[model samples]
Target chain A: MPTFNKYVQIEDKPSMVPAGLEKAITAAAAKDTRIIAVLEDMGFPGMLWFKKNCPERMIECGIAEQNAAVMAAGLAAEGFIPIINSFLFADVGRAYNQIRQSILVDRFNVKFIGREGAWGEPGISHNTIEGIGSTRPLPNLVILNPADAVEAEKAAEAMLQYVGPVLLRQESSPPPIKIFSDDLPFDIGKAFSLKEGRDATIIATGYMLTEAVRALDILEKDGLNVGLLDMCTIKPLDDKAIIKAAEKTGAIVTAENGTVIGGLGDGVAAVLAENLPTPIVKIGIEDEFSQSGKMSPKDELKEHFGLRPEDIAVSVKECISKKEKLRKKRK
Target chain B: MAHHEKLVKDLEKKANQIRRDCFEIFGSTQMGHAGGTMSIIELITALYFHHMKFDPKNVDWPERDRLVLSKAHCCEAIYAALVELGVYPRKTLGTYYCFGSPFQGHADRWCTPGIDYSGGSLGQGLSFAIGMALAEKMKSVVKDVNIGQGGFLQRYVVRFDPLYRSYCILGDGECHEGMIWEAAMFAAKYKLDNLIAIIDYNKFSLDGPTNEIMNVEPLVEKWKSFGWWVTEVDGHDIRQILDALELASKLYGDYRPKCIIAHTIKGHGIPAWEREHIHLGRGAVIMKGIEEGRKKYADV
Candidate 1:
């Protein structure tokens, strides 16, 4: 197994994301009076904390995601930094045109906290895997999907500090184990390399990073040395880090909790095809809707979608063999 | 005539001039949103020239009242008014709809000055206007009060009065969008009296008559049900529009949003244009309308 770096401090206990988001936003709003909370009908876990602490800053838009989207645009125009929170399908999907025409066209300063991923009981309606692909093409919008609690808090703080449009995805997997140390040095458009290997490298984003951490162990047991990279900022993908990983390993496997169509896999594939031409395999949900599944000892959805550590280990071996075949042909 | 009468007479002449200018700009492009633009001449003229608070030189002054044109398709009227107020050069009117022109087909705040919100999509402006109005209520102007005792200075915070209002103009056909009612309920729930919305009830949308396409009849009851202080006026009459605006502004402290349904006809001013429900007049037909408009409104 590759040795974990200083940035990797995987704790034993798992923590919920809503608590982390609440802490970060509460700290940011305490100092900046311009920050306001604009929420839809389905409130987050600690939404009442905001209403209790800063009642004047809370705005209830009530089931009308379209109205809330345009209303936040208006509030942003008047210098109030409004943060809208909802499910990805409701906030970004139901109001896609409003976000594009009203918000992105003028590039309003609005923050969206969209929660969507797989392996939950809400099923396809709430847990859509298309948010990443759908929002990728919109101009002037930065998309961030943090891997764990520490990274989530840092991404939220960074999103608040930046003065433009940003969408932070809180993936809906069983809560990820606390993975990063407190002082991880997070930036908007950079990636963090967790381990280095010669055989192959696995680039992971969102909750899939935790699975990749486990996949590294599985590969090591099978006598293959693999590297791990945490890709938090999906947009403005860190070309240097991706190219370095490609150059070192010559084979790549991309992992995400969503679709492979336009998610992190496509982004990495395009980067490799244009720059390095490395052997790559994308690991994500196929072209179909997600259904209800359990996350117990078996983890039914992960098993069904082939997103377990065993699945990732299989893909890694396949990628490495592709690289070995290419070398043999050249010789 | 009395002084008030003279003021009304002057505003009427200004309205006539604004109508003629809209026709001339439409003729320059040989095509434009002639019906809705013509219908809102008196309402737009009353707001920019006679009612709203703005500086032609400093367009982004924080305290200045804002105009959120939700039905941005009829941007020619706003452009003509901006030119009249010296916000843009008169020559800019000739470049309407051309590339790199500030007079975009829609009312974009980034491209054009004197525009508060960028709008091309319908049913979004009222919500945007409500946002500005809510923000204005929350905005504060800070003043430092010095309490000096033994050469020691202390500061105190005091509340400032409301400085500006947000005026939004929407089209009757645009009411078909469900987002309009969503905004309507929101403004009422917040009791945003600082937001004023005026509807240009010109009886037509893009396809055909609004009633035949999708009837929005019983419109007044709809606004009243949505909790707005509603009123009706002749959109073409300068006195009526001015009086309604003045009344709406006076009700600011009453804590209720206002909606004025100004009844109007498609292609209102020129007889040749008014005979047909022409949403976008073009070429020979618009030229004929311009020829007729010059005879009626040029000298005045």
Candidate 2:
């Protein structure tokens, strides 16, 4: 087993995604009185934190995600920024129409923090990997998926600072690697190039970014030059960075901890197919329902869905060979 | 006549004019929500012309009261009222649903001036109203402060009226949405008394009778059970709607949101369509001929 050298040793605990979100939101509420935290029944430790710190700014809308969504729009209409926290299935899946019609149509400044991906042994019902794909089609909605807790905090701040609607997907199980610094720069539609090379480029998002970095390290040991790009923003995709990567590498592989169908893989593929026609490979769940078991759901699901870093490295190698074959055929 | 009576008479005239304009606009479009729009003409007129506090000149004024037409398919009526209120030009009504017209088929807050909330999808308005009401509650309060000057202290209880009232008009058919009840329970739980939800119980949905489509009977009891102050009114009677609104305004301090179930026929004004299974956009082609003749004769 290859060691993840960049990963820092930290106490294993529940994800700091919610904790970072609560801290950032509470701090923002202190500065901006217009900020309000709207919660469905799903918000846990974060809800408790908000209630304790900024009780006046917190709105518990019960388990009704639909009402929670529309109420956030209404509050936004009245010059208030309402942040909704719920599971991905409840917020993005159930309230998809509400977000599309009420929020996005009017460009309401409502922020949604959707807890996504498998964790805590939750069944397939809670293990939602399609939220990014589902919400990506909505016009006027900014989709942000942070790779780690630090990025999650910055993402929370960025969502609040920006106007209009934003859907920030936070992983329930935080990545073991701390890829970003405490004060790392985070913009709404900008992609972060973690490493740069010319042979092949790996574009990844959310939990899969950490895995992509690990795969890059593995490929480097084999004398294969590879680049790693963290595509945090899914919608209004970083087309500039993607075009740059496509032109430089001519071989692209997208790795995501989501279904390969409509997630980051499809997004990057569309950009490359349109702009550069690069040979591409996608690494993610190949259209299958995730299973829960006694082992850590995150590890089991990642292994079961072929989201391991080794798997991504293999796909990248295969894509590079395809690019070589295409070059020879053209010659 | 007394000032209140004169006001009522003026509002009644405005209601009739709105109904006429609504019919004319829907007829011109040959595709508009006529049945539900006609049913709630008097109630909406009472709110916009008589009860609600709003400034057409400053439509985005923070202190202005808001109206959420939850049953937004019936946007022709709101468009007529908005036109009459001078928010938009009277000629804008002629461009309803025309290609590239800002007057969309449904009530869009962003596209139309003076519209507080967009409501095409049903059962969303009540929640939006609850949110506005909650914001009002947060912003509006009486606070006591002490000021010290020259070693002398002065205390004053500075009280301000609530920011603004939020009125949401929902259709009986819209109540079938589970989110409506969710909003109902949320508003009651938060004691959002400043929010008033008026259900236009016209008794007909898109398919057929509401009872046959999906029974939403015991509406009053349902709202009451959800902790709202329930009141029933003849939706066609401007005076009854005004009275119910007045009662609702008084009940604000009781810490209960108000629900006024306005019983009305599907098409209250148009005789041929009234009491029939008149869903939205139906009978518009027939009404178009009548409207053209009336306009030609200056009979509005």
Candidate 3:
């Protein structure tokens, strides 16, 4: 196991992803009785709140993830919107076939809440980094990775408003800093520009958006202006935003708390490579399976994975230099 | 009970016709699941012709009872039955498995009419049926408040008659999947009395015999242990199947789901094809022999 001394201390924030999701579901259930929440063996604190509000709609489906997925599809088939809650590895990884066949193929109105991302300390088994990659190829699935509790709540409500299958990935650890205001306009398949710059663009998603903001601050201190874009929706990607970013800033660096292979980085790169060939650098876990061991602090893990602010600054500088070299070669 | 004999005879004739139609369809396609399709002819007939309430004109009627063919590969029997009921055109049967045809090899609700759920992957329909049953249970409760001048007359009337039931036909081989047992535990725990599951215990699977491949024996006891009202019957006998279904329907709202283990042969109608481990591709050869004027069975 690798270790690092550099640790980014997260503030003691009270808001959490599960709490926000539960609050959103409870509020939505009051308006629409068709909303049903199905739980696996994993206990969600939101279940109690939902049960207290809508007692008859709670379905405790035990530890069987496969059955839970298909049961949700069946409920959706009968015009009831079912939200299934489970760990990311268990729900999206284990019951992938059921989600693909029964839910996505039929376009059933089902919502899946996959808790715990690459930031959790419960070891690699509980920490899921490839959920977005695994579910990205499935047709008719809307994938959302919320940056913080506020975005999580908004994403939950947005999923309810949408009428098809959705996979909303919720991080296990809460972010110390708030990224979005209370009145931020959130929509599916849309990207939000946090900061504008012309030198290079740092497009990030999920928890990495916080790190991207910090990196942008670091670059600004050096008098380098770097643009920052928060991509919440992975599938049905905001191609227009990405193309605009690439055209405005000739260099791009994609960051995500997932694997670099088929996650947000590859998704952005695929569009940019086809639309406009820009010099891009990806910042995420390389091609390897993460291990389970002693828990490390979030900052140390970021340093260990080369995901710190300084590391991102280094990649952004490299991307800018690469773009310069390509320009000179063209001349 | 005097008219029971006539009902049984009529159902038997319909089942025989469906079996013949299934074999002919498979013969024409030269590739289809005839064994399992033939095994569930009587059960399908009993449900579509006698027990289940469905309107051929309106396939999406909310009050109509739903049937999910969990053994989806055996869709020929369902297609034949639908054609007989006029839900699908008679000429569509000839276009089975052809390009751009509505009649696919598997039971896809998106492609064909009267199919409640799409099923090609097994071990999923039971859970889907439980979902529909749960929906019906939740929708059936009606809160009626009639306020008079003196006081308010509030009555909670649960109309079970209008509430539709969900029936699923599963294959014995499909039970080998772990999802089936997971669904079973869930259905029993919720006490979904509106859901009924009928397993076509045809003994043979795609590769070989179910017992030799993977024995799912003591099926009745297993269902009983899972807290289901278990019943065993001769699947080919229309009266026994109908009686089991009727008993299952009567047990609605009892807080316990029903399971009927129907013991049946692999190739029920044709004696020559019986005892053979027949699947999709294997049926075309036997069907070809029948079409080539090889009369192996006098009755067929």
Candidate 4:
């Protein structure tokens, strides 16, 4: 079972976001004619489908990402919702200033579907973990990183429906098992609580949620009650849910597939430090570039980076111990 | 005088007025990009007064032609145009570069009225113009196709005939950025005939001469190789600038974008301002140049 929660019906099959984005965008395009696809040679699953369906709506911008970014801003200014898809490094990293000055300055309604993760053959050049950190500081830009196929689809739909600039980080990683049920209630900037816990809460995003769910089972078998909070929307972060989690669990362990420096870990830590102070352990790529990792039989990068379910369980215990030590010191 | 002669005379007078307005703006702020701003005055004046289809009464007109001032540091010229066109009061010129003012240091579409694209970064405006051109082409294309009884389909049949043209003004020194060529190739590939670009070949950047700083030499050939219809015009001459822009606007169905290399002095008017390599000036120095420019315009 992928998820031990009663509300979530885990599908037996594994899936990725490129497929989910394809389904979500194509469906969204059918209804809204304003949607346009601006690609940077990295055709992510939906390019061919979009070309076949709406030929004129899909633009092939070639390998020029900077031009593509400003072009999307122009299209957005004209009231057409332009979606630029590429690796996060090329889409955000290469065109950082273009996206900042041209798009985010006036807050254009541009959707960027950036793909990147640690577990891939593309190596460090393509898989940049700094995207979440770099983009989080930009004003008027919303960031979303979905955990499962269902959430990806739902997030894409929500992203399209919303106005202004948004970046949906589609992870290029091993397929995640379906976690959310069909009738999952998804909202922008809101966190979904799978289960409540008394010992510690696991706050995860993107591909790390699958490992988090598995960690929940491991902790349960060891006679521990751990909660899981799916923080899909990284920007405009769900603060109430985080405070509630910290209040209930008194300890938090953050997990993500990207670097923890400016990613979800730091975001959660900032929130907890300000609102409700809680002992926390961050589980992610610790201040390093991602290299080539095997993905077939075993995700070697996950093991190498200490992001496995067992690693998360250990971090949870460490966080709980920190909380206990703090209580003892207060006495 | 002939009708074209009268039109030329009117544009020349408008250009002179805009030059004075630029001086007024510089005098108020005591800081401005004087050299490049003076060089592009005739081009801006002609576009606002004669060429572009903009309504000063309604700045946000849907079908109005767009202008992407890519060399946006010299937005003082555009601000002068807005003042002359009655979009803003003359008092607003005093607020230029202030803490809270619509007339910002650079072209900002949100802050300033009649500005199409927010720009300060060079080599970015051409791509934005292409986008606006593409959008205009899309809108002028097949809105809906009807095939006999009860057969209505929405097809994006990209018709090249766009109702409104999109123009971008670039600086010669700004061509050093590689993204300019990237946008140029994309425009040629897509055959955006509705787009027109003008390069203010003023030869000087902030540091020194453009060729000495980093040459964008053989500039016309570079654009031509990127598949653009290149034209050369004496940028200071109002008649020649209008003629080039007119030819570019009328060259429809050519399946190529147009570029006009406007060779101009760094500061076109006022011999004192033209003599100095003053890309930007502040306080007493800029105030001195504006005074000299006012004296020269009055004498003319």
Candidate 5:
């Protein structure tokens, strides 16, 4: 399959805790009776912390996602904090309509914590690469896809107080351990620039942030100073990030753990296409269904879709070089 | 009960009036549903004028009962009934289907003051009604809790946890929707006795007749399997409809949510409104407009 030499190991069978999420969950649920986790009573301490604080507040309506969505709506109507959890398949498959009608339409303060993406060896139906794009443009649905554990915790704390429907997508594999602190407050509709460059801007959200950082380093080795942006929030995207990234780099390359169509990559490209018209390349899955092989084929699947870090670095370099040539021609 | 009798007696005339109102509303839009609205008038008449416990003055009274209209396209009948009950100015009927009016040829919860849930999507209203009923029951007062005496109910004056009933109205066409079965099975499982779901079993749907599309024959058997107290009535007959509903309300100890299938013909009240293509938006063959909408109503 596809191999990332640095880290490529599954959690013995299926242990549900995807790294840094445990830490973030512990911190976010530290104080708040209104917030509780609805995950199965597995070894995940994050769930344990939630049950400890908000015993009555944390609603567990079984493993049924549809019931969770409906009960969340009921709780929201009655002024209760409701958080629902599951893998991509359960949330998007059964509870899609329920989430649309009851949760989103009612504008309930409900939290849908699930893995954001169509990545890794999660199989075909489990590969929710198109999940974010499909859920976008749903009127008041606010989707925030955090890159790592710290961002996830910050987003969770911020969304807990926000009075709207939030589709919080967390990475199945935590990238950076501590990207932020209690000091750098996480807000909605905002993006952060990690590094400044003059060649190309690489905008990435969710687990793709790690790849964007790596791609930038690869470009730096090639004497190209590439810009990097962490697009934590997908819907109500950080337009300022796109404009700033474009003004500084002149060309852009976008990436996310979702389909290239309506994912963060498109969100970035759509902005540049309209405002700046920059030479941009998107690194994500093309329009195709993921394979349903026996083993989890995350890397192989990503490679098949041309989402490798090398592919991203090469595309950004090529785009920036092409833009430079076009400028020269214009001159 | 006495009011119910009067409604049953005047049912035929009122049914015609409602049918006329439906046609009139449709006429205003030049293109709107006719068959379903015509069939639902009598049941609507019985529910609003007689059955449902609500005051026109206090629309959102805490304890006031509510109706979940699953078939929203028959909004004309609902609007007409609301107006007839003095819940709002009858003048609102004139604005039916008018540009930018609250009346959008469908039951808009915002526009129509008492519509509990906006029901554009079919088969979803019953679930919402269940939530409301659950809220009402859960929010009731338990003033004093004595370990030996149980939770005491304080008999007070204002803000009485008004014993509200949830009436969910469904269409025969809606029976084909899979979600309706889910709602029915859910009602049966929960034993939600306070929920009264009435189905307007008008055989004719938008495309010809329902039998041709999806024959839900032996409908009562289906509901019985779903663990419901099924009651069948001639949809146009007010006495039968009222009697069945009264039987349902008075039923004690049986916690199964009741289902009243009012077997009806689409466009039942109005003769012209139901025949062939005329009722199915085949050009305003008749000035089925409310002013002229009166004649098409075959009340008796």
Candidate 6:
């Protein structure tokens, strides 16, 4: 019903604390002594803010991600909350068994923060253009793929209060803010409606959430209302919202910076296929390792992965047109 | 003191009986790790029935001390000790590897009730012990447990809510896992002198001798390099295992963990099981003819 009109230059780049991740961490740390952080030693001066602010709470376990995961498991088992931070690929590949046996098997309430999911050519090393599929089978894990810094911060804060294991994937670079603060805290297991429409529901996570929101604008201009939901919590999903959207909308497009098979798209499909079958299109990195790109290739890579807002806009328009034809045939 | 000596002597007799019991159990199973079980009997007996502070009546008492059999194939010895110590019923020893038995070949933490951790995987027990020890310190309840009834709602809170010291029986072969080295480094870093890791250095491994398979020779020097107060002893010698453990407890300095390399023969009791190359995937290596290997020597 209402839109924030602080509209500025509207550029693509965003600030590091775009959504309030820093603020949330600061506030959360002040209240809980169990919060300890193992920062990656990749020389990101950005975390110098956290380390300097909470010297007693922050412990860097050197470059050993495997050891860090076990250390976190040990701390969690002993009633301390530890966040082992690294990129998604390294954390998953290096410490799969540790997470499987020590963390998941014990059901220890530890937190894993994978800072970047699929950032194309931040260096191919940083790109997990195909990441999320590998994570779906880990039992009892709650997966959160936040769209922007604000959502990331809120999710991070909400998770510490939870009594089970949680993982939050963060974007190395911030994206456009699609959902402004309701001035109220967001709870886990609920999806936020970025835009309300009836044409088709587009589900997205990671950097693609903002793109989905922008694509909905293009649909709205064409007099076709589109539904947009930021599916932040992928596991123990907001099934009610997804099923309701599918029942009303009849078509969907899911996008993520992860693999197409098991990211946000598959999660939505599993729910819809069981409840209300619908035509769905998915966009993400295919099964291929990312190649080297320009030093500043964010824009180019975003387009390459069909993650640009304009690409989403086109997909949305084509789906609506196809649906209109099919409806006519039904008539 | 004479009475204590008599109890120790009685315990030795019980150990010999347990050796026989283990043989029967292994024989019935038609397949079991006999050599290891026979080797660690006295060590298990001394720790469970005599030294370690535990409550058989209240097994999960938070304050009670913990003993992890890292060399868990010798679980027959642990099970035998637990049965004698009254944690498990004596009848269960007969069902060692029997169908639907709570006991299995190697101790499974999920399956075995009294064992703190299931450690057949090797090298993992040290890490688990480190966590337990750290938790005990953090809880700040520094006392061992005493035997008691489930009554008395306002008991002494057991003087301790977790163990002040933790004992682990590690297999010399389990030292092959690199994770052990990492755990050692961690122990050193945290000044975990309260955590005593004892290597069940029986000279034999499954295939043959550990030294020939992969030398753990100069084991003390290896531990010393990892910043531990290393002690070597005859594993089968109750006095030596006890003295080395006591000496290790007293050697206090920051960043020096304790590692006791207790050496013992693989099959110290049964002659055939001692150094014989029993073929792989075959049963009853120590045949009926050579029960002389079953002779008990006054090695102590």
Cα TM-score per model = 0.94, 0.92, 0.92, 0.95, 0.81, 0.80
List, residue by residue over B163-225, the lDDT tens digit for candidate 5.
767788887777887656656654554455667888888777767677778898778999988
Task: Name the better of 4 and 5 by TM-score.
Answer: 4
Q: Go through the candidates in order and give each one's DockQ.
A: 0.36, 0.38, 0.36, 0.46, 0.13, 0.13
True contacts kept of each: 0.55, 0.55, 0.53, 0.61, 0.03, 0.04
Candidate 6 residues lying further than 4 Å off, grouped into runs, are A1-22, A38-60, A120-122, A129-131, A173-178, A182-185, A294-298, A317-331, B1-40, B68-83, B88-113, B118-122, B136-163, B203-218, B252-255, B265-300
* C-alpha RMSD (angstroms) for model 6: 7.4
TM-score of chain A for each candidate?
A: 0.97, 0.92, 0.92, 0.97, 0.84, 0.88
Q: What is the per-residue lDDT of model 3 for residues B1-300, given as tens digits with 9 covering 90 to 100?
A: 233898999888888777666756776677778778878999999999989998888989988999989999888899999989998777888898998777888888777768988888888889888888877766644654332221121222345553788999999999999999999988877667788999999999977889889999888889999989999999998889988988888877566889999999887756555646567655546665345323433253
Task: Give per-residue CA lDDT, model 4, range B89-156, as digits (tens).
Answer: 99998888898799999999988878999999888999999999878766655544322231112332
- Model 2, A1-331: lDDT tens digits are 2222242222333345665677788788889988887877763643546666665666777788999999888888888998887788887789988888888999999998887775437778877778877878888989998877777888889999999999988875434466666767888899988777789989988878777767877898888888878898988899999999988998999987677888888999898888888899998777876656334434666666777879988999999999999999999
lDDT of each: 0.86, 0.79, 0.80, 0.87, 0.66, 0.66
In terms of lDDT, which candidate is stronger, 3 or 4? 4
Query: TM-score for model 6?
Result: 0.80
Q: How big is the positional error of residue B4 in model 6, measured in Å on the Cα after superposition?
A: 6.3
lDDT of 6 at B45: 70
lDDT of 1 by residue, A87-160 (tens): 88888899999998889888899999888998798787977898898999899999999988889889999999
Evaluate chain B of model 2: give its TM-score: 0.88
Top model by TM-score, which number? 4
Docking quality category of candidate 5 according to DockQ thresholds: incorrect
Q: Looking at model 3 chain B, which ten-residue stretch has the lowest summed lDDT?
A: B147-156
Number of backbone collisions per candidate, in order? 0, 0, 1, 0, 8, 8
Instruction: Residues A16-100, candidate 5: write the lDDT tens digits.
Output: 2244455555565666534545543222422544555444334333344554555456445545455666665575456788777
Give the per-residue lDDT digits (tens) of candidate 2, residues B1-300.
123777777887888788777766866666667778878888889888878998889988888888999998888888898889988887888888887776888888888878887878888888888888877866643432222221111222222335688999999989899999999988877777788999999888988888788999788889999889999999988778888888888776666799999999886656555645466554644475336434643433
Write down the TM-score for model 2. Answer: 0.92
